[model samples]
Target: MDTNSKIKRLTILITCIILSTISYGQTSIKNINLKAGKYKVGFKHYTINDCTRTYRIHNDFNNQLIERPIPISIWYPSKIENNSSKQLTVLNYLEILKEEEEWNDLPNYFLLDWFPYLWNTPENKAHLSEKVTAFSNSYFLIGNFPVIVYAPSYQASSIENFALFEYLASNGFVIISSPSRGTETRWLEGGSSKDMETQSRDVEVLLKEINKYENIDVDRIALMGFSFGGLSNVITVMKNKNVSAIVSLDGTERYNYAILEKSPFFNLEKFSVPYIHFAQKEIPEEVLNSDKIPAELNYKFQLYDSLKYSEAYSFRFHDLSHSYFSSFGVLFANRDQRQDKSDDKIMVSYKLMSEHTLQFLNAVLKNEKNAKEYIENSPVKNGFSESLFSKKMKQAVTKEFDYKDFNDLALDQGYQNLIPLYKRTIAIHPNLELQEGMLNTLGLRLSFNPKKLEQGVNVFLLALYIYPKSANLYDSLAEGYFYNNDFENAISNYKKSLVLNPENQNAINRLKQLQE
Candidate 1:
C-alpha cells in the first residue's frame, strides 16, 4: 500500500477504537442491585392537557393553539399478583419517551439513534428486555402513601429516572413525573430562566394532580429533580408550602444559582423543608479547561450556603458525573471518558445515591427513626468510605415561631386556649405578634360560619387582649356575640366600642337596638 493510504487506514482504526470505548461497560437495571422494599411496584401512564396554558407543535404544517399536553408517569405501591410477564420492560419506558418527544410514530428500530442520549450498543439493547420492578395496569396498594413529585432533567422524558421511581414505589411511595418541556412547545429556550419557571409550573400541576389519587397522603410530599429539574424544583419548593422535603440529584441549582434567583418566588426562607442534594464529583481540571466550565462550579453553591431553615444535607459522589444521576443516563448515555469514572464505580455511586435519597425521604416524609439517623450521621458511619462519598449536614437554624405556628397550636386545642398559647409563644419567640388584622380576618371568616362561631369568638377575645384600646376589635367582638344570640355580651362590647370611638355609628346603632 502507498504511504498515504497506510496513514488513512491507521487513522480510521483509531477512530473506531475511540468510538467503541466511549460507552464501555454499560450496566443493566438489574445490575444496579437496588433492593426492593416490602411493597410491589405499579406503573401507570396517562396524559392530561393543561387547559390554562396553550401549546404549539412546532412541526405541524399550520401551527395552532392547543391545550398544553402533560404526559404523566406514576409509580406507586401495589398489591397485584407478581406476574413477571406483565411487568414493564425498559422498552416500554422508551416507547413513552417516543410519544413524549413529539415522535409518537417513531419506530422502535430508530429509538436509540433518534435520541442522542440512548446508544444502540449490545448492552443497551439487552436492557430493553429486562423486567423492571413495576407492573403496568396494576392496582395501587390499599393504604395512603407519601408522594414524591419528580421533575426530569432539561427536555427529558418523564421516565428518565424510572429505576429510582420503581425503587421508591417498592418502598411504599408514589412518584409522579412529567416530561420537562418548554413553556409553549416541546423544546426549551436554551435553558433560560423561563425554562426553569415552566418546569416548576409543570411540577405544581402534578402537585394538584396528586389530589385525584385517593391513595396519596397529600401532607407528606417531596420534590426530586436531576440537572435543570433540580433548579426548577427549588423555585417549586419556594412557591409551594405543601412540600415537606426536596431531593436534588446533581441539580443545576448548585452550578447555576443565578437562573434560580431570577425566579420571582425565589426566597431562602420559603425553602424551610428537609433538603438533600447529591452532587457529582468535582470536574477534573483537564475537562474544566477543555470544556470551558468554571472551576467555581465545583465548590460554590450559593443556595446550599444561604439555606438556614432547612435540615440541609449535601453529598458528593466521587465516581459519578452529572449524567449518571438519572437511570437513562447511567444505562445509555455515552460517557465522556475524559471525566467519566469507570462503569463499576458509577454503578456503586448510583446505588449510594438511591439509598441516600430513600433515607432522606424516610427521615422527613415517613418520619422513620433509623432513616433520620442515617441521613444525620457521617458517610463513614453509613458504611461508605470518605474517599468514595462525603457528606455535609446543616441543622435548620431554629425557625422563627411565626403566627402560623401559634395558630396551629391554637387550632389543635379547638381555639379555646389561644391566650395562654400566645403568652407561651411570646416567651419563646419574643418578637411573635398575632397581627390584629390577621386575627380580625380569621375571626370574621370563622364567625360568619355558624359551625365555627365559638372559635370565632375565642379568636376575637385574643385579638381584644392584644389590642385593648382598638375600636375595631371591640366592634368585631360585638358582631361575633350578635351572631351567636349572646345579646348581653354583644351590648357590653358595643358599649366598649363606643367608649373607644364615640363616633362609631355601627356601635351606636347596635347598642340602641340591644337596649330596645
Candidate 2:
C-alpha cells in the first residue's frame, strides 16, 4: 500500500468518527433547568405490600404467595428548613430505581451500564453527581395540598419522572407513585390487557394511600403517567370517580385505544374528568417506513376523538419524541438518528411541557383564574411558535338535569325548603322533575326515622305539590304526619286522601283510628 493512499483513507475515517460523535451526543440534565415553584420540595420513598393481591418473586425457589410489594416514591411541598447535606442527588433516585427494579443489591457504580436504556457515557456520569431539588424526609408543609397519583411506564421505577414530580411538588402539589409490574411477577406479559389492568389496580392503591397524609387534599387529586403508565391511568380514571383530572405525558392512550376498550370498566361516560395529553412530534416518513409503524398512528387518536364529556386538551410538541416525556428517558434514553430532535430543542420543550402541566393543574384543581386563562389560550398566544406546537381542546358536553340530580339538591338542605328549591331548579331546567314515586319512598323512609319526622313531612308536602290530586301522594303525606304524631295534620291529610280516592283503605283506617 502506498503511504499517500493510506493517509487519504485515515483522513476520511477520522471525519466520519467526528460527525458520528456529534450526531449521537447525550443531553445534560442541567440544560433542562426546570424552574421550581414557590414551595420547597420534599421527597420520601418506602415500600408497602398489597396483601390483597398475591405475587411471586421470580427469584424465589418456593414461589410462595407473597403479597404484592408496592414501592412508593412521593414528592411534596415541604417546610423550608432542610438539611443541605440530605438534599437528594440524582444517584439517590437511582437507588430507588434499584429497589423497585429488583436489583436491590446491585452496586451503585454499575447503574449506568446495568440498565440497557442508560448508556455509560461521560455526560450521563455527570448526572449522577448533579443535585436535584428535593430534600429527603423534610417536614411537610402544613396545608391541604392537591395530590397527583403517578403510574410509571412499563415495568419502570416509581421515581422515573423525578424532575416533573419535584417541579410539581415545589408548586404545592403532592405526587405519589408506584412501579408498574405484571400481575404475578416483576415483569409484565408483553404489555397485554391483563398488564394494563394490573397497573390500574396499583394506581388505585396509590389513590387510597394518599388519604393517610393529613396535608393531602383528597377531594382534589390528579393522575399523571408516561408511556404505558398513561394507558393504566385512563383505565383508573374510568373505574374510579374520585380523580379530579388527569395528565398524560406522551401517553399510550393516544396509540392504544383498543387496549383501553377491552377493559370492562372502560365506559367513555365515566371518563369525565378534566384531561390533558402532551404528545410527541410526528414520526418522520423514513423512520415510519423503516420501523414498520402504521402511518395512521400519526393522525389517529380514537380516545380523544370519541370523548364527549371531558374538558380535554391535546398538545403536540414538534421537538419531542415519546421517550423524552419522562425525566429518566430524557436523561438516559438513546437518541434515534432518524427521528430524535436536538438535545437543546428537547430540553426547551420539556420546560414548556412542565409549565403547561402546572398551569393545567392550577386551572382544574385549584381553580386559579390566571391558570385557566393560560390553559385556554393557544400555543402561539402563549409565546410558542405555531410550527413547533399545536393544540386542540374539547369542552365537556352539557348533560341533562334528571331526577337524581334534583334528589341530590333536596338531600343537601335536609329536604327543607324543597318547594322553593324545586321552583328555582325547574325554572332553569324546565325539564327537571322530582318523580312522585321517589318522593313518596323518600318521605316514608324519612318518616319511619323518629329524628327525621319533620323532614319527612316536608318531603311529603313537596310530593303532593308536584303531583297535585294524586291519591297515592296524599296517602303518603297522611302517613308522614301520622308518624310525626301530629294528629290534626294527619287527620286533614287522611280526609284529602279519602276525597281523592273514596276506597282509600289505609286512609280510612287511619282516620277511624284517629277519631277513636
Candidate 3:
C-alpha cells in the first residue's frame, strides 16, 4: 500500500474508534422511552373565588385586587376509546409577547391575531397544545400511569412551555397544568405578587375538581411546577396534604419561604412528605439568600426552612441564564438578532439540566430506588467527590481524608457518623483553600468510601465557600445533598456548579438521573 493510503486508513480507523466510544458512553437512560408527539388529554377551565386575590399580599409593591381567571388542563393515560386523537402545540405566551414586542415595536398588550395559529404551522406542529383536534394523532406515551398535578408560571398560559410537561407526560406522568388568569400578561409587568394567594387556592380547587376524572390515582398525585409555578406548587402542597411529591424547575426559594410561614404549610413539624426542588444554577442570588433574612420579618425566609424537609437538587449550567430551564429560555436564547449567544455550551447545559430534573422526579415521586445511584455514586468532572466528606476535606485539609477511613467507616458505620469529622476538619483548618493536591487526595478517599456522603457534602460546601467559582465544589455539594435525601438542596447546589462549568459530564449524568 502507498504511504498516503496507509495514513488515510489509519486516520479513518482512529475516527471510527472514537465515534464508537462516544456512542457507547452516551447511552440514554434505560427503562424509560421518550418520543416526540401529541396526545389527547381531558381538561377543564374554571374561575374560583375561594382564595385571596394576589400573591405576596403583604408587599406594599403588590397592592392590587386578586380577581383573575384560572384555567386548568389535566392529562391522564386514557384508552383509545375514551378519547379522540388531537394535535399538541406547546406555546409560550411570554415568548410570543416578547417576540411581538420586538418585531412590531408595539406595546406588550398589542395582541396578534395570528398568535394562536402559529402552532399550526408546519415548523411548530410537533408541539403539544391544550386544544383538541378533529382527527386522532400520534401522541407520545411511555406507560399507563396515574395522574400528576402540574402548575404553570403565574402568568403563563395553558400549554405554555410544554418542554417539561410533555417530557413527563410522554414518559408516563399524567399532568394537570393550572394557568394564572390575568396574571400571565401583567406578571412581568410588575403585577405578579398581587394575585398569588388566589393562584395557590385555584390550584387546590383544580385538584379537587380533577378528582372527578376516571382512572386518576389521586393518592399517587405529584406536583410539578416551573419558576413561578413551582412557587405555587410549594403553596398548594402545603395546604393540601394529598400531594405525594413535588418537582420544582428552577423555582425561587422566596415564595416557598412566604407560604411556609404564613400560609397553610407553616407547621413543618406536621408535614414529612418527600419533595424535590429542580433549580437552575443561575437562580437569582436574592432568592437563595432569602433564608438569610430574618424569618420573622421575611415570609420567604420561612419557606427556605421548609425546603430543609424536602429532597432538593439544583442543576447548574455555566453558560445558562435564569430562564434556561424553561422552554422559553431555550427558544429565546436561540433567536437571531438577540445579543444573548447560544452555543454548544448552552445546549449541553439545557440537556444536562433537563435530565437531572427527570432523574429527581423519578426517584422522589416514582419511588425508583435504582435511580438513587445516579446521585449517590455519579462522579462530577475532575474526580470531585459525590459525597460530603470528600468535599469538606478538600476545602479544609492540606491532605486528603484517607479513603481507608471512608470505606471502613461507610461499611462499619453510616454516612451520618462522618459529619462530625468533616465539621471538625472545617473548624480546625479554617484557612485551608482548595488546591489540585487536595482534590486528588479527596478523590482517593471518595473512590473507597463513596457512601460516606454527608461528610463529603460538608467538605464540598466548605470548598464552595473558599472557591465560590469552582464548579467541582458545587457538584460535590449537590451530590452531598442528594445522598442526604435533600433532593431540593442537591438540585440547588448542582445548578450553582453548572452555571460555572456546563460541560461537566459527571454533573450532567447525575442531573439526568435525578430528573428521570
The whole-model lDDT of each prediction reads 0.85, 0.84, 0.48
- TM-score, structure 2 vs. true: 0.90
Per-residue lDDT tens digits for candidate 3, residues 289-367, read 4323222222222343434445444333444544445554453322222222344444555555556555655665677
As a TM-score, model 1 comes out at: 0.89
Candidate 3 or 1, higher TM-score: 1
Error of 1 at 305 (Å): 0.4
Best-first order by TM-score: 2, 1, 3
* Candidate 3: C-alpha lDDT: 0.48
**38-95 per-residue lDDT for model 2 (tens digits):** 8999888999999899998776657588899999989999875644427889998998
Report per-prediction Cα RMSD to one decimal.
7.3, 8.7, 24.3
Off by over 4 Å in 2: 1-25, 80-85, 481-492, 506-516
Tens digits of per-residue lDDT, candidate 1, 308-335, equal 9888989999998777898987898777
How many clashes in each candidate?
Answer: 0, 0, 71
